[model samples]
Target: MKYLLLSIFLCTLLACTPGSATKYPYTIRDFPDSLRTDLRKIVNYGFIGSPSYESAGNIRMQISDNDCKRLALSEHPILRSLALDILCNRHHLDHYSIMMQHLDDTAYVNWYYQCASFTFITVSDFMVKEYKWYTEEEKNRTVEKIIRDHNYLQSAYEALHKTTLTEAHYPFVRKMAEKETLMKFRSEALLHLAGYKKISDTGFLHNALYQSRHELDANAFGIMELYQDPFYFAMLKKYFPGGYYRNFCKKDFERNTTENALSYVSALASYRSEESAAILEKILFQDPLVPCFPADTFRLRQHLYEVIEKNTCEHYSKMLRVVKPWLERERKESAENGFPIDTTSFYQFPSDSTNPPKIRW
Candidate 1:
């Protein structure tokens, strides 16, 4: 019994040692002391009435229940950054060092933006203000930091995926939309600005949206459907008329460089215009870029069809018009492969998923 107790004592001692931290996921023990300290501060999420909870400055924020989950449990590296992203956003704590640095690996940046907490921060920053947290000094400093990140351009852009611009940020997005050196980045800024529904300078937007000389600028083309400006239609008529929507750089999608074209498709579905239906139809037949999409071609087309159906009153004509061209293209393409599709079993959206009759693949 005495020997067994000694063995247990030794085991506990070893586990508590600094070297043991590596045994935890994410090699947490190796993390810098300061980083760990910051994590500790956040993981210690204050209770509802506890002193750990930060009171408001000019505003009080009732952060969502989902957002209130404390991050103290997980020791993963990405989760640590996410915890920081959430807790800092909730408390209005400043200094987003890890995610802002361009030198950081793709895993950290991708996860930081991909996580739910970051989305909340982006959407909530503006949303909660309608009801808001943080000291005046802290809020000002945080806003200043955001401006600094914005000035950093690409770095800021990556981080912005995990954050959103508030009313004050509308001006920043507006200026960037017009003055940014790169047309693609300018288009991105334009999209961000448009989300606020406040861009009034049609002349500037038209010039930026159509002035691009590239064979395909996803960022610029990406925003055309949202604004749906007559100028965009004029530009589309000259460049792509009668449902010709195939200029997304497939290479960019493979490179994981940017959101690229699949994002363009997601945005396209929201557009109800006849032009949009034509474009969606072209891709529905076959998008070689399906690997980059959130879903397979079949599923994507199904969703697009549903969206178009919802948007247009002339659903049957629009569906037939779009499908006719796609079917013809498919027949030619399938003939080349010597394996033509059976048109008898065409794809359609199941308006009622619960119906057992519609469950066929």
Candidate 2:
């Protein structure tokens, strides 16, 4: 009789915990039938659609303050996050205490905001819901919390990166970029610094790039590309040796070697130097050392052409003249070969009804 009583007591305690199966149902059918219909709809289908903001906003409006508070008790992280959004955005209630309790809720939620859907942890969803209204001190504390907890770093940064950050936040961001062991977070921090254009240190970008390895290289190159500093011209040039961007000629398509080279190509193209132009001209015209399929070459050339067209310099005048005829020839060949012919110009130049403009380059 005592054993039976003790077993029931233990089961009751487990059922009441935050992540218990009874508290947080694994299936929709397991959720209590008594839940309000509107709240259930938000929890079940809120993450759908490409840009889900309109639908989500409408659903958020139907939740009452009382109903929204009840949602905070749900073990479903998405529903809990929805509750947080309602409390702050609709009712203008203080939900910081509730948010603190959910800081460790690492369950992923795909939230719709600003005409785009982003997948992030439940804590970040609510933090983002309330971030815009936070005072400076509150914002600082939020950043500190993100720094102290790795779980919040990526998702919180995604939601907060565009918010108005002043000079005071630079050091905190820089530390994460340089010192954080997680490359994804470090890369995000590096891009944040570049995006804000607030870094005071001259050597920071160079050092960051120098230290980057493997997947981090793409982001480091992206930072340099965004910075647009002529000082990195020599470093950019090193990537374009042997008439093509590094790794562009690799035979292994599975490794995506050529695709990965696009970042380096784009970084180099941002420079207007004669050396840069000459290298790119070779890339545009020369046959590869290791031949790719004709289709692959055409696609690669088209991508290269788009980058070149966008960043054309006086040095590219000769190359541009040669390119027009080559592209016209390719278009004719594609038509004869029964491939679908694109009506747009090879470089996607805007067409005029009569007499197209000469030399946009």
Candidate 3:
């Protein structure tokens, strides 16, 4: 027992000795000093929530009325001098030094947050416009890219998993798998591409892999599908494969629905068929509680009433007026088909504890 203890002690001491384990064969520290310096600058200046540490005066002064013209003339000595002065004065060497040590750490965080927020705002606006800016070529390119990226991820994972022996390799392999899955799942670019194509070709809009209205961009196709067509809704279900619809249905009703409905109503007004009018009436008189209830259903109804009164076709005008009273009655009684009366069921409204007024006569 004494001999065994001595052997254990010797082994522990050896393990703790300096340079006992072999160092990695490669080191990133070998990168050139100039490259390292630039990298460091990126890290320091890009950290999230890190103080800009730049002088407010410098930031303000950088934005001149003629800055656009100066930028266009990229080789201008004056512009270059101004830029250098700003960099040197606003961020001291100490700040640059700190940034170099953690270059990617700060840069990646800042880029990720900026991209994420911008994507959210862009998507929301795009959806509101039914993806007006998206073109066919762009959609196809996005789809192809997603396919390529996904295949590359798969190949990398398979290669690593087959060759690695150390247990430490498992974490990396697992991470690759997760990344691939997430790309397949929440790849907004790919999903939007598919959605844009589907809507343009089939009159049906589909949801993206992820809903980014709050973070990246809201799926315009998804919004249209929710309000306009059952076909697009089915596409959303097929792609998402879970309770995605239920979650989507819970968004602010009047805001999303009213916008979509208005767009649809305006586009269909020229058709003037009974079917179209009936569809308009149905939308205009939906139960205020439905997920897609218009924000201004009352106003929409009043407008429709005026349109009907002014129509040149006597029969069409008569039919519209006839339908208007029934719709109004249904709205008052909370009895519109497919539309519920309680808008507050899908979203909370700001109000005191007092009971809401009843719509009944």
Report the C-alpha displacement of residue 246, candidate 1, in angstroms. Answer: 5.3
lDDT string for model 2 (260-341, tens) is 4677668777876688898887676666632544235556676676677668789888777866666678778878888576
Question: In model 3, what is the error at residue 146, expressed in angstroms?
Answer: 28
lDDT of 1 by residue, 200-242 (tens): 7667767766666343356555667666666775665455322
* lDDT score for residue 320 of model 3: 64
Please list the residue runs of candidate 1 whose C-alpha ends up more than 4 Å from where it truly belongs after superposition: 1-144, 148-150, 159-164, 181-184, 196-200, 213-222, 238-296, 315-361
Highest lDDT model number: 2
Better of 1 and 3 by TM-score: 1
Is 1 or 2 the stronger prediction by lDDT?
A: 2
The TM-score of candidate 1 is 0.40
Q: What's the CA error at residue 60 for candidate 1, in Å?
A: 42
Ranking by TM-score: 2, 1, 3
| Residue 298 miss distance in model 1 (angstroms) | 3.4
List of clashing residue pairs for candidate 1: 60-132
- CA lDDT of each prediction against the hidden true structure: 0.45, 0.60, 0.35
- Tell me model 2's lDDT, rounded to 2 decimals: 0.60
